[model samples]
Target: MSSVDICEKHRQQSTKTSFISFAFPYSHLRPCAHRCKQYVVGRSYLLQLQPKNRRNSHFSYSCEACQTEARSTSTENNISTHALSFTERLWKTYTNTATLLTNLFPLWTLLVAVLALRRPTTFTWLSTPYFTFTLSILMLSMGITLSPRDFKRIWKRPGIVILQFCSCYFLVPFLAYVLGRLFKLPSDILAGLVLVGSVNGGQASNLCTYIAKGNVALSVIMTTATTLGAIVMTPLLSKFVLGTVVQVDALGIAWSTIQVVLIPIALGMALNRYFKSFVDIILPISPVVGVIATCLVVGSAVAQCNKLILSAGISLQIPIFLLHLIGGICGYFLPYLLGYNEVVCRTVAIETAMKSSAFGFVLACLHFTAYRVRVPCAISVVWMSLVGSGLAVFWRYKPVQNLKGFRSDLAQRLRQKRQLDEMK
Candidate 1:
């Protein structure tokens, strides 16, 4: 039997013994009187009481106090155990399914798009209002997960957080713009790529940094700061880069950013603060909502792939996608070489590389009719999930080599231990 069953059995036995002891007065009970009489007659009949009878008698017996106690304990145990098991199962399912989907989603989206090319009308449903709603829901879920503690930590370590955000908002976007210009990508795709690069770090960056044993607080702050900055930066950079190719209104893009990004986050923060108990109650199930929203968004993007491929063409997408992958790698590691610690480096790298493609895609749909504008963002979404997850796993299990600085820290810790031992 499972440990739970074993524990339940023991609990029931204990409860039965307690109830039996409480129910009968030992001095006045017939069994006790007879046992005493037998003892006086120099016989041991007490041992001859049937064990089966003792066990069965307790089950048939019920006392008001004992019953109440037993019922309360059982109910509490059942609820706690059930809740724990459900959480464990949900986490297992999310990680496993996310890994699977991340690996296969891009290829699946591309293949389905190619197959459905001849019957374009079949996939037309991807452009419906439901798809946009799913995107909005995904953003809301992401916003709720952003802890305020992240910002507090940034106040403590402003330099590191600022450096990380600079890498994300300034360095990465400029690199992507330069690469896009050099490659001479099509107008819509180039605008999309620049927009993707111009946006802030994704929500997944915090998850990745946490897994990597990095400064997750810094990552969260950087994400929040950069996201706020994106309201102005994304539109301005997009206009500058895509001005010759296509018209983009910077003020309009800023308003869209405020509508989609700022409003939801502010509302979520307020709700979380004012209804802290309610948020705590729902926090366990928040991941479920996030996973469902993510799936819907991906499915919507995939369903729109035919239009994207038709308008942008495979050749343009292939090179730009490759460029994006390379840019992400460069963005991730550059901070490390610039004297930041591994944790800061990992955070910066992830933040710089992983764009908030959901934001980009939503903005694209709002601003442009061309489905091709979402192609780079869609592809990046899948690519970064796969790459970021792998990096997270790697850092989680990666052996810690005692470099000079780490060894010095370890030495200081050992010295403190020795001093404490001496004091003891």
Candidate 2:
């Protein structure tokens, strides 16, 4: 019926006779007419057996067809095994390296920022054009991670999206204004603080969201939406907030946003959709590359403003730190008050707190003349990154819980129902 069945049947017959002799020619490749047993030992078939009574007890047979087939099968198997092992080894190496790089992100950014501040010349080589290119690459990496399915989630939950947008635009900007006024900051510093607040969410917020076990898809959508809106919102908010103090060039900032941020993201999405196989291989490394690009952008900014920073006192640090802290706290509490779950709250909070400070630094250098104008944004990159990373690390080990209002609201409803029953 089958080779295995035939081999099993012959194996039983072989056990009956201690020895049997059967022989066949190598060329004929056909079974001999004489009745004989056939069995398989290992990979090759055993075609003959001799009776114990015979002088020569060992049976022998030759068939070039069976031997050739066995040899060919074994050779192919060896090659396939080697190929599979090599591929698996390569994949493991890639994933291990990528994971290492992703985990070391906080260290990477902090180290680059400290080094850049200490030795400005080391990072000054990242000029304006190279800086913009690097940002585009970072944006492109972010884009490749997204898909059409991710965008559909945005439409599915418009309320969450709108709430995050409001927090990004209104809450952060207003917080910056209040902090600036309370600190009694100079005109340039105030303008820079407001400008940083008005810019879109930074790319690093996605990493923080992932670390915190927040809604990563929501974080990506929020970043994408805010960045697209920044073309108009950043300039308008800056002009409205800072116009009294400085001559704001709204047009220039809009053009820069379009050129640097939007196009790269679009290109990356197109490439991911079209060249999925290639992207899969590159995707693991993209985050690490993005981290390096971000470091370069921050380092360049620090290098540019090294002198102003060394001379400035603690007065400058307080406002920037407060801006991020206030924004983060407000972002969480407002959403929690509105009855959102903890995941959404965490996502919104991170997006609100981590502004595109690099974009702010670039705009400041382009539009503002005062050294103080660039100082807040330059320092913002360091403090916001540290604060966000700390929150992410804390959240990673902890479980997310529902807002306090969830229990309070349930109790209030129970009370109202009891009162209605008593009245009836």
Question: Compared with the true structure, what per-residue lDDT tens digits does model 2 show for residues 73-183?
Answer: 889999999999999999899888877787677688789888987899999998877877888888888888877787777798899788888888888888888988999
Q: Candidate 1 residues 83-117, lDDT tens each?
A: 99999999889767756544444355344444445
**What's the TM for model 1?**
0.66
TM-score of each predicted structure versus truth: 0.66, 0.81
- Give stretches of model 2 more than 4 Å off: 1-75, 403-424
lDDT minimum window of 10 residues, candidate 2: 17-26
Model 1 has a clash total of 1
Question: Which ranges of candidate 1 are over 4 A from the true structure?
Answer: 1-129, 146-149, 310-314, 369-371, 394-397, 402-424
Please list all clashing residue pairs in model 2, or write none if there are none: 19-50, 19-51, 20-49, 20-50, 20-51, 21-49, 21-50
